[model samples]
Target chain A: MKNKGDIFVISAPSGTGKTTLVRLLLSRFPTLSFSISYTTRLPRPGEVNGQHYFFVSEKEFKKSIAKGEMLEWAKVYGHYYGTPLTFVQEKIAAGKDIVLDIDIQGAQAVKKKMPEAILIFLIPPSWNELQRRIISRSSDSPEEIKKRLEAAKKEILAAREFDYIVINDVLEDALKELVSIIQATKARANKRWPEIKRLLQA
Target chain B: MKNKGDIFVISAPSGTGKTTLVRLLLSRFPTLSFSISYTTRLPRPGEVNGQHYFFVSEKEFKKSIAKGEMLEWAKVYGHYYGTPLTFVQEKIAAGKDIVLDIDIQGAQAVKKKMPEAILIFLIPPSWNELQRRIISRSSDSPEEIKKRLEAAKKEILAAREFDYIVINDVLEDALKELVSIIQATKARANKRWPEIKRLLQA
Candidate 1:
């Protein structure tokens, strides 16, 4: 019998370079799978439907939520976004580790639903670095930047709830830490029980 | 404030290549420290007094035990062995991660006293491999080999008490897993709280 795979719920405030890290992580670990969220928000430039997100109508997104098909859902900035329960369950049952990139609230909801899910928070090295990243990556007005910074602080406080934290000081170092967390989780006793049992019996 | 370090307690059955893996792990992670146990047994070939173990008389070992200086101790093969409590506490409080190579009972004892200590178990990939390694590495008689195999089986069963398991299938792969476990533990939320808090305040 195969051991069930792990569910890694990774959350980070905007401008923490989480997206880039996740992209690199997925590429490095071929067996790792990403869970794409279903969103009612319009796709941004270069974002593909079903690849980046399953772009859905507001009614369709609401329908999934009402039908209990969504594992975790939240309305952020007036856009509905959620993870589908079946996809995550199927992948994990098939012994494929899945990465879920979501906001803090979504991560909390997922953790509540699936207590085994490993929660990871990504943060910038410092507040100044966080602000620099936000400003450099966006064309937001000073007021907008201020608002995002405030939100980031609140999210950073919630980081205490996470099981692991990756400091995005340097891309390479952050990626290496992230990879170590994934590889280490795979070595957990519960995850390797089947193979271990087989060896003992043999 | 400096971030408090971790105590990684690694346990394995005989012939699992644990000693080789641990030697390589310590070489790679210079910041990591090893906790040498005090033993009543005489030093084997190539074993240094303080480096390999603190060779002590049985009376001295029992005195330490009476004084509550031993962190964890066990009698095996008519020899007394134990960790020095003050050394582990001082190194950890000074922000140095320490690795403890101990038996299953000692690992369980350390965990009881220090709940935060991460316990890792190393095992051979297969029972046949475990037997082969034991036979090849020693000049033990067939009866001694049989006794060791029985002991190994019991130790393997105790692996469930561990937090992580590294299968010693390929030396390189096992070393990589061992390193990943150490790196990942350093990234744990509790371990990085000081740095994370400083960033938030800044």
Candidate 2:
């Protein structure tokens, strides 16, 4: 049997402070390893191949799917995106905690496979604030922004299904809370059996 | 609508350092609280009502059951043992996180009622070690110890159903990990919505 690693899936509306919170979490806990998705989409300006995504060709992406290699895959913005199960498993085996910034659908899929993964949904304070944040992203036009806002409402509702709901109200405080949770979950006796045995022997 | 506090059910066979972990967690984090179980057993010397087990009459305990005041209840050694639903609900309402150190059956019952509650199973390093610890407690006879160990094996197997498993290998290290998990779970954007809202407004 494989020892499972805890997966924290942080989901939110595009501009509900998820990226910032993730960045803060990464910097605060260098031990945290972020999961990079594999995408068939072209890289945006200044985006590195592995850092932003594992930019793969359609042929390779298809081959991966044929090999049943991905943990979860979805079509987004006319491109294919997926999480490589092997990459995550390897990082976890190396004793590093990994975070998955994914959509609710992807999160659910991951959990269905690994039920121990923690699903954390980030919500905007309110519909109005979510609306404002979406408009500010500047990656979309007026019509596109409206579509995103509409999608966000459904996504926020999806938050109800998540394991925990944290509002991105404050940056530092939210990040601190996350750090505490990761540490706390590991303290569990079942997860710490080997360590506990070692400690008791010590 | 109630913004419920997270319910953490912590269970372990005797002498796996569960009490030490909980005590350390409570002392270190003021936000953490313990759920005090209520029992219909007569109070021993120096035991106070409500503070220790909420001492009550069998009639009163049965009345509580009729009123649905208990979250989970069991008759043990001619005594009724249970958790007061009202006490735990009140603490949640007041925004205090509560930890329940209960039996496996109680944990399952509570989880069914509050599906959001996180379940953790604590274990000793090994079955041999668990036996040694129980024997060392000086509170049970060899026969009683055998019964407990036998029961523990059943409980440990059932732990596979729990959300997380923590080994009580080293008290301090195990406590630290438990602290970390609780921290991360609470920090989850889903759970921290209120704080996130307040922070953005500030």
| True contacts recovered per prediction | 0.78, 0.46
Q: Report the C-alpha lDDT of model 2 over B96-180, residue by residue, as the tens digit.
A: 7899989888888998998878888887876677878888885878898888877876677667667777767778766766766
Residues A150-198 of candidate 1 have per-residue lDDT tens digits of: 9999889888888999999899999999899999998999878778889
Task: Please give the range of 10 consecutive residues that has the lowest summed lDDT in model 1 chain B.
Answer: B193-202
Tens digits of per-residue lDDT for model 2 on A2-95? Answer: 3456778887768888888988898887878999999999999999999989999988998998898999999887899999999888877776
Model 1 Cα lDDT, one tens digit per residue, B73-128:
99987999999999999999999999999999999999999999999999998999
Which candidate tops TM-score?
Answer: 1
Give the Cα RMSD of candidate 2: 5.2
In model 1, the clashing pairs are none
State which docking tier applies to candidate 1: high
List residue ranges in candidate 1 displaced over 4 A. Answer: none
Query: What value does the lDDT take at residue B176 in candidate 2?
Result: 69
DockQ of each: 0.83, 0.28
As a TM-score, model 1 comes out at: 0.97
Q: Give the TM-score of candidate 2.
A: 0.72
State every prediction's TM-score relative to the real structure: 0.97, 0.72
